[model samples]
Target: MMGKNRKQFYFGGSYVPLGLDKHVPMSEWEGGMCEMRRLGINAFRAFVSWNRIERIEGKCDFTELDYAMELAEKYVLHVVLNVGGMFNNIQGFRPPPWLSYACHCRHRIDDPLKAHIHEGADLMLCADDPVLQEKAYAFIEKAVLRYRGSPALEGWSIWNEPHGDPCYCECTLKAFRAWLQAKYGTLDALNERWGTVFPIDFPSWDDVCPSVDMSPYAHADPCMKLDFLNFLEDSFIEKFNRISALVRRFDPDHTTTFNLQGIHGHDMDRFQVTNPGISAYIEELAVNPRRVNLWLNMYLRSARTGRDGQDKIRILETDSGPRPTGKRPGCQKLASVRDWTFVAHGADMILSWIHRTRITGGHALQASMTRWDGSTPPRLETAGARGQTILRHQERLLGASPFSGRCGVLHDMKMYRYATVERWHGSFNFTTNSHDGAFMLMQDAGYAPEFMNDSMVLDGRFRRFPALILPFMPYMTRSLASALRDYVWNGGILIAEALFGVKDENMEQFWRKTPGCGLDEVFGFRCADMMYFDPVKDKILLGAGEIIPAEYFRECIEPSEGAAVLGRFPDGSPAVVSHCWGKGRTLFLAALATSRYDYENTALRTLIASFLENSGVLPLFKIRSEQNAGALGVYLATKDGKTADIAYLINYAEEPISFALFPDAGILPEKASFTDILTGKQYDDFAEITLEDRQCAVLFADRKDTAPV
Candidate 1:
């Protein structure tokens, strides 16, 4: 059973038992368990599909799951069972036929050219259907009660990527109406907020319906569409609450959490749990493995501020190797950095996709730790070596938490949804482009910033950061603007990029000035006009005589009193401006500079570096490395009441690089001694250390306290 002080870091891969779609025998299942023990894997995910467990309505089968739990107990391994209605669509085992076509109720939204039904396949049940919810809850209750006391059961994954975006059937329409009623309170209020008129006005609540057309030119009103999207997400959260409450009624001693697909579709503040899980596949979250740190820190910050205020997270699914027929090589190299990245960020558990490859069908030649015949490959060997290394120092490592920066980057969910509604480069591309670029730029300068989401802003968490960056944020809530003003008034540095606060909380353009909600006075600027241009032809000139290429979006600005112009466009328009407001300072870039700071952009990096230094927010200790030493990562941690602080270094470069650390006085004791945790090498003073490609190093240094000297 897990308690408040429980601190066991789990690491393992998933496995499919016998009699599933893959048709593995019981012998192979037992062998897989043995392999887990040999590889130092202490926990795994056990899948319980609704279709498989309940072949006939009102009758359930627990034979296979029972044996799997017994095997886990015998092997001294922990199990995180995957049950309930909301599981992965592909491996979640499609719903049973009785729950599928018998009720004639499933997602009816589909392409005009394609059929909705397939042979031997079933769609997910409509979540708004009362009958469906009753049966799903019944199944969940029985499953939790059966294994609540099992020695090996650790937790439950109640929802897998809970996104109901595709369901637009009659049942969903009914739910959407009810949601609107609760929000607007009356049809007249709804009509006023939605701005509905004669031909399109919602005369009655019954006339309101969500749009099924998702094309670029769909005629759905942005206001109505936004509410529909909110309703979908809220419906999922409601289902999660009901199911979680039911589970807790029977099993209150173990952890309960749900998995989300990356960080796009849901609100971070809505759901709070001790352990929050995410599906962190590189293909889904990052363009390449080297950029995975951006998502890692974003989710880690969310988990750190969870219900129990613990810094524990679960990577419910990550890539173990490359896909079949893919051109990417060095699977072992990528896998090592991926798993270690989780550890560097203070993650509690790491669970990859699968343990062994399948022998047949479309999933043939899929990536797995072991071959179909149960032989360990080079990748598996690398995993085993890393596992042994982590197990050796679990006590000290688990006791420490990753250090967070005094800086913050804003991630506004309202702006993210507005982008989707406006059809401006889509949601993920628009938000992550700016958020990831700002995050990477900070890390490149050896300052890793935490992410402050919309929830954080509303809850007064934004005031904790000494410096904050708003990257390409265009939408603003009145509450958020008020918080930013208060934060700046109390002496916090604020930096915002292009299109900051052009739209209100409801995606309405501001009538007075661009930075709405009194932010014009706070930032000392008003956007007169804006333009989009071809970045290849335009350029920006900094006050220091540095030439930087322009990006796609730029804003024309008029500076207010006490504001100074720092940069100019080709036409001599104000490109960047700075102001003194209250006791703090504010900087505004007329262009999206942060979105364009790639690995090769030196000019932008220099400009951003100057901004940090001028604001007195740069890291005290600088990590210097040779050129082409691709994206080195540095993370620090300290045990409670201990004099030794730990630092973790990760090198993503292809060639060997020499690293040196220089400390600023009063921040790090100049006479402190260094000890390598992995190698046990002691250095009398800070010295140069060599790290090969994709290497991770842990160093311990004695300190007077966890504060500046």
Candidate 2:
């Protein structure tokens, strides 16, 4: 294994296939590689279409891909070969005419192209279909097996964004039945859980497929519907694992990844999981100037980091520049700063989408590094500049990781997705919002959190944290509840927010009062009253503070002998409650509220800060500015170079400001001296630096050398 301090980072663009060319031309691809090396880019990626490489079932060719690889070698550029054709038409997969005519593939009723052939709108081979998988694997094996010896293969994008999973084909039906049979073991258990019965259980399971429209099943048992969705999600994961295993058998030196919409497909948004075997992530939820899309999208792809604990994420494809308003000028600064944010956050790579702009495809907004005539654009220059920075600081930046923040906001796909479908659709909602809202508050408080998704919790990775902020997790399982309890009992702080442990994995309301599933034992509180508080109608006054904003759900806690009321509502009911559990205490905020990172509300901000301070979970690094004067998005990155621990600061405000750096004592120097890298301008006289509007700066602090620079 490589030393801990050593790492490799990819910086480049997707070399778009030469469109409108026959016999697989190499001129444009070769030119793209030359351009990449000239820009100081060490690597570039290209999407190799399975359908195009093997247009005929048996007769296959790697003309375009082989040439592309050869050019990459000639130009000394590392190649991230994205295999598996995605998209529907001319730009991506060209489903063999034989398969198209022979009806070998399948599509869901909702497939846009199902109504009329539009050529690659969102077409994909049915992985569940035996005949298609058999032929598809043949194409995959042949296309990739030869590349096993290719020197430029840094990574393999097995597939990009398969999130829109569809197709209720015959084979999928059989797979779903097998999955259910294995899960339930018998029809009795299945019927009991799903509230359904069939005389011929095996055949009945085999006969069912994805529901085109779930409306007709309005009165049907929801668990049954959710089961199918779960089955479909499992099938996709299985397929990813199968293909990934195939590639690793021949090419073991590269990282493998799947595109986002978690695991792939928008339909599975309510529930998604990763293939633990997949080595990397080429994510979605990306746009040009990735910051504009960073946080929320990070929420969607954060689970990727849970794989191997090394958050090696890359942008496989996305709008090369801002997709808004044609091609605006001076957008490069934002783009570069955005790229820096990704690096500071521990992402190993970023490919800013296409190297050559699109002309023939349906992707009009898909701008690339260069214009159609191959002229360098501002976007490419910015990307090149970002790449240069990564190349220079590759060792320190990649070697160090994000600081383990004092407090965290937890997230779970299983709970959030299930709750969304059940509470809003099945009418059993416990909280108005997901934990993303609480994350905004965490950010506003100038804290970066470790995202603890369900996988992380299940893998026993959440125990190390000193404190965790769980926001509105209603669909927690018995095991997860015990995990949380164990953390709290083992002297770990837990601040659970709203509807704390009230529902089960199935979103089934636990008959017991609030804090269900033995969580009552953990929290030491029982629900006295439960109802939604209408902001306009009812009031929840927090002590002498203003009325708490109306929230979707509120649980009035009746504290037990050991628990105590920290805050109360206007009606004299407890709004915030705390109780000692073993070595630590759990604080429960009874109402849901969100603080905007930039436009933070006074009441909400004050409330959250007090909670953190009281729990001894204050922010690790404090920006000694005029009490939130500027809209600066502060992100701190550790530096273990010869000296100097670093924190990256991005001024999101329209104007510049000089903010002092005073990290928590042990995390930084007691004297706190620094210098900005962008300008070798030393800050020996003081511990602060100025940044322009929408600009980025890196602070280098040496603990051993505390004297001002």
Candidate 3:
């Protein structure tokens, strides 16, 4: 029931109840609801803070709850109730003080008095505590019982971004020590891994204290730090699971999920598994740096990450209010980019962070759709238009899988997270901070970027993605290395970048007598000389014979028996090379030289575009006319052999361009004559059409006997 197929459409709405004031009635709620409904918003992820519901322990209030549910049902809008409060116990919802006392345990590692010194918030209850679990279950059971039969309820969000630093309270320390002892048998083994020198008599695990002090060589092992991070992630997952089980008992059909703070230090892979149907909150700046496009590429990739392909992807909250810091980019551009991108990426629902300006409360700056003057902003209009477009085309876009073929980019979550830690060492900057650049390049070139998990690789799914791109992943497990070697032997395209295969599971440099695939042979290169360039001088040097530029730090290596150089370093060493392994191809970009914008250049774009074209991974789209060159947006949707719809083109820029499309050309549209769905502009002639930038054109085509365009 949680994974049922729901018709896909851009469900758009704004965040309501921007503040916490009981006296402020729902005076403007009706108008805001009417406006969103008119604009085609079918779903709303409204917040139902825990602190607000049970202000005092056992003193529950359902007045606001009943009002919200009634409003949702009256408007025919589904709701995703955000139970956890938003901020760091500042506003929105939070656990009441009395409830906290009831659930509090000695296992919490964070000190209540010092908690506000860091993020300025009281310590949250430890999930491992039995008392905390009982209270959490009680709260969820009560809430679910009230809304179980309500037609307005769409889903329940367990907690808001809970991925932060570990709680260092005494309670957590004791639990952690117990956990370590069970795994290693003794504290001496833990000390060995933690690099702690055992004195004449080392203290027992029970006497050990969890301290942030990483002084003394003994207590500061990198492996220990890594393990601690993993343990914290596991603890968070346990909390989420406890809450999910409680909610499911009363509301079996409702979905449950948690939002991850994008690019934050949380272990996403673990969080994704804790609750299989999780949806990520797509922050404005997190995915879309330019603030123009909706980050369509990342959303589609994330949607597919749902377990067993049964989860619905939705934008928990988008930026519909003022730009943070009143930046140069206007809110309209941000809204348009987000709106159109959501439609393109197949997001079923969209919710913004604000619906009305908060007059006298927390975070007043982050307003909703209506301003302080009770007037609608330009962004509201854009959201409405985009919502209408999605509603009109929902049937074709939803419930369809976009990826085909076998090639995929292996996404090792551990490797990706570890890459972040490695950045502090200052040796590599190989797409280290972000995977968006590498992912976008592959997608824009028409290749489906499959996120192959590490476990999936061990299960042989790694071989299914005929092509695998390891974008500067420095560490690899022994198991992963063996899988890669086997995949290569069986003919799989392996694309690797700089500083890869250098570290083992312990984060130690591999020092074997014979060179392992770790780094010495995987890319036919080894680290010889590495340099960091000043940001101003960080330019990729393009060789005379090369199409793309060479990176700043170049690794010098000799080609293997079957490998040949495709591009070279300044010193004539191989930079980009191709090696034939079994029946597949191995492309090695030996340096970390290019920026994300480099992939947008015409040359690299054309090269990658051409590669995908030849690889037979391009999507088949029907068109009314043919086009070449210029910025193009193409979308294709297909159902069981009965019917298919193709969204031809849209220009997101501000210039008009023309290209030719020949009916007999190899890339012709599948339909003869098609009707334009956007402007309703019909075309039956086979001729080139000039399109103005920032304008979208959609043509609906059928396989019936129609004249060729």
Better by TM-score, candidate 3 or 1: 1
Candidate 2 C-alpha lDDT tens digits along 178-293: 88889888766776776642232334554544334445545545566677777766666556556667777766666765455332122222222222112122222223222343
How well does candidate 2 match the true structure, expressed as C-alpha RMSD?
5.0
Whole-structure CA lDDT of model 1:
0.70
lDDT of 1 by residue, 128-247 (tens): 767666677787788888998888888987776666554556677788899999998988887777774223567777788765464655675578778887777777777777777787
Worst 10 residues of 3 by lDDT: 273-282
TM-score of each: 0.91, 0.86, 0.82
> Quick one: RMSD of model 1?
3.6
**Candidate order by lDDT, highest to lowest?**
1, 2, 3
- What tens-digit string does per-residue lDDT give for candidate 3 at 1-709? 2223366453654345322533235776666667667767777766665566676778888777678778878887777776542433211344455545554443333554565453324545544555555665677677778877787777777665555346776556666777677767877777776663223234776665443544343344566666666666556566665566666666778677655544323334454322322233334343334223224454455545523333345566556666455332334543554455555444566666556656555546554566665566676777677678767776755644333423465555566446544444345445533355555555545454655566767777456565766765657678888888777776666777665666777787655511245434544544544454333544333344434543444444557766667666545566666666555556666665333433335455454444444544342321332333324444443343223344445554445656443321333345445566666776654366666755655555544475522
Top-lDDT candidate index = 1
Q: How many residue pairs clash in each candidate?
A: 0, 15, 19
What lDDT does each candidate get?
0.70, 0.59, 0.54
